[model samples]
Target: MPNFNNLQYASEPGSPTSPSEDWAQATADLIVVLDGATARTETGCSHGISWYAEHLGKSLLLAAADTTLSLVGVAKSAISRVACLHPECDLTHPGTPSAGIAMLRPDGRYFVLGDVAIVAESTDGIAVIVDERVSQTGVAERAEVDHYLIGTPEKAAALLPMKRAELAARNIPGGYWIAAADPAAADHALVGHLGLDDGAPVAVLTDGAARAEVFGLLDWAGLLDLAVAAGPLELIQRVRAAENSDPLGAKWPRNKASDDATMVTASVAS
Candidate 1:
């Protein structure tokens, strides 16, 4: 078996202070990333996505600590706990706060929900683990907004409407799902294992941080290299720098100018 190395991590909001809505935490054997969705309209849950993400992360960590619970079970426990915190709010609100989750554990098991990702580097190249079902969603407003030029005022103007549409499609048939008030969403999560004997490196990231690679700024190999050499936060900084240079999103079209970013890197062992 490959001797495991230390796990390192970094996280930052797209902007200052409002609490980024992106959450990440790592232990010697456990790593997790959570990306909270932006609300289209105000949901009854006044706690906000950032607070929801933070609470959910804590609950998930607590759930994961229970050796007897399966990953799905852990997700259920977390969801239940978070839901309980907002009994007075409409948990079923279309705009209810939710988050995508990506986590790795000592058992070589991996769990994924929504767009948060886990990329594994092997001798051959890189393999990305993502739940792409979100794309298959047929939300017309989102599709229409997606057709707009990114970084343009038109795209910016359409965001709220598009977000409203996204909510309509979430957790429903033919729509993408995430960790929301319902624990049932966890049943829809993706779970699997990695063999540590190969000593492959895995990088767990929130969508914002992974956007750099998506925008072609860095290849998977290059991203991994930078993470090891300069640290994961550098990758995010580089992305921010690139974004800064093109504040208008003219060079690269994307939904937002900046996003909450987080990354965790580790070499797993059996």
Candidate 2:
């Protein structure tokens, strides 16, 4: 059996709210993390991002309940429904529109979208599966484009035309996975999966917690070693420190740049 643990924290860089992130876990088969996109519209439907994230989390939990669909199928179904609610935007579009998802399954099938990072460690060391971030759009240039994922319904309605045009111009292909090439200034979107099997443990982290800086500043490998020796909660603390420290952050910069952090650590038993 694979043993796992997860933790999440959201710091409201703008809103009065403490955190704008959400997470879900499945002991029997899967683990997921969803980050709400910044809203750009005023339709009040922009809250749709949160609703989408939370809804996806719940859908995953419930779909797994059916014990029929694989984790991928469950996620697909949830995403499909969420996409339906906001016809203005489509999940398969080219831009880094609004949502993200990462999952680890019992069969060693792990899938991810957005800029979340997943690390698997074993005797082979560590294999990092990182979601591509959208390329940087520049601090100044972004202002002209409205810097946020649609949040409220009104915003969703209002931004639909602009977003649609943007999508059309980009020639967004239908059914493409969504993601950011650079979470900070993303332009490209993504969705993909990788197989994991080796004599080791697995860890998945949001961009904030697993950036190159965290690894350089704290000896990420050493930290992972310590986490294995100590436990997930302590490892969670280490990630927390990385977020606060921004040890290697100079390499990666963002506009609305506060990252919601989440990390899941697991061991594949012999």
Number of the top-ranking candidate, with lDDT as the measure: 1
Give each prediction's root-mean-square deviation over alpha carbons.
Answer: 2.3, 8.0
Give lDDT tens digits, candidate 1, residues 180-250: 99999988888987654445677889888888788899987788778866788899999889888877666
Q: Least accurate stretch of 10 residues (summed lDDT) in model 1?
A: 1-10
Please count the clashing residue pairs in each candidate, in the order shown: 0, 36
Tell me how candidate 2 scores on lDDT: 0.50
Give the least accurate 10-residue stretch of model 2, judged by summed lDDT: 179-188
lDDT of each: 0.81, 0.50
What value of lDDT does candidate 1 attain over all alpha carbons?
A: 0.81
Which ranges of candidate 1 are over 4 A from the true structure?
1-4, 122-125, 138-140, 146-153
Model 2, range 136-230, lDDT digits (tens) per residue?
21223333334433333443454555444433333233322342221221123333444445335566656555543344644556545655566
